[model samples]
Target: MRIPRCYEPQPMNPGDSLMLGDNNVQHLARTLRMRAGDQVLLFNGDGQEFHATALEVDKRSMQVRIDSGEAPKRDSALQIHIGQSLSRGERMDYAVQKATELGMARMTPLFSERCEVKLNSERQDKRLRHWQQVAISACEQSLRCTVPQLDAPEPLDHWVRSVEADLKLVLHHHSATPLGDLPRPGSIALLIGPEGGLTEAEVQLAMASGFRPVALGPRVLRTETAPVVAQAILQSHWGDLAGN
Candidate 1:
């Protein structure tokens, strides 16, 4: 059986016993129905995987004994930061989840002028937590040892001006440069618009802020689809998926 891996935030050392609480404990004890002696993999986003064995399982909590640590092979040479306009409903969630699986190091939800999804204070807080969980689940499913950092939602104007990356790209259907024309970099930043797409003015603003306008071939991809396709192509060309 494929053992389920859990992302634990606590510092772990070899031979240390750890106790899991909250939803994670409930899922392992009740949902997975895992019992004592079953092996589990644990990671703390420290770029290492912990080989652990279940010591106790109950409705209240689950405990595991850490055995040894093994440094995991790095996933990608490319460090990508995605600055995406916040779309409505599950569309944004899908984008965040897929980006995490594709090895984006950081994500910032951009609140653009054309963005239709507006969150009040309470809703924004709730949604941020939900998005964070989505990222965590993606890491578990993808077997990624490091979890991607999801930043607090910020306005597009402020975020675009502040993000520092070796290369910055704004997805535009009319832009001259295709992905191939750009210079390769160890780090890249991608700016994608919301459902209605970026307004012409916003596109101009992005261009003025040192973001190179680029196209993904001739096709116009949806807000959610663009990031996945772009990241896959980038990784295949310049990241871990390359040369294989």
Candidate 2:
């Protein structure tokens, strides 16, 4: 059987007997039905993975004996920060999850003019937590030791002016240039608009703030699909996806 990988929020040392709390109990106990002596992998988002064996398993609790730690940071050298406009429901969740898989260094949920999703402070907090969980799940599945940073939601105008990167790009289908014309950058700040797409004025504003307009192809993708496609293109061109 493929060993399961779980995220633990606590700091851990090799050889420690760790008792998992409410966070991981249900998943390991009921969901996976892991039994004592079953081996598993654990990570704490500390850029290391631990080889662990199930010490105890029950309905309420699961204990794991951590054996050793191995550092495996499956991160791209080209740091890419995705400024993604917030979409509704699964669309937003899909974007975050896929982008994490694509090796984005950070993600900033953007509130744009055309953004359809509306959230109060409480809803925003809840959504942020949900999004973090999505990223964590992605890391576990993708074998990425380090979880990507999830930034608090911010307005488009503020994020555009603040993000620093060697190349800054805003996706606009009507733009004159393809992505290949650009200089190779060690870091990129990529901006993707909402479902309705970025208004011409917003695109102009982003360009004024040092973002260059780029095109993906003739066919336009949905908001959720755009980030995953764009990140793949970028990674293929200059990031780790181009590996030997």
Highest TM-score model number:
1
lDDT of 2 by residue, 1-244 (tens): 8998888988888889989868688888889898999998999988899999899999999998989999975788889999999999999999999999999999999999999888889999999999999999999999988889998899999999999999999999988787667888999999999989999888999999999999888889999999999999999999888651
Query: Where's the lowest-lDDT run of ten residues in candidate 1?
Result: 235-244
lDDT for each candidate structure: 0.89, 0.92
Q: Which candidate gets the maximum lDDT versus the true structure?
A: 2
Candidate 1 lDDT, 1-244, residue by residue in tens: 8888888989999999989857778778899999999998988898999999999998888999999999888667699999989988889999999999999999999998888888888998999999999998999899898988898889998877888999999999998786667787899989999888999988888888999998888889999999999898888877887562
Error of 1 at 84 (Å): 0.6
Model 1 regions more than 4 Å off: none
Cα RMSDs, all models: 1.3, 1.4
**Per-prediction TM-score:** 0.96, 0.95
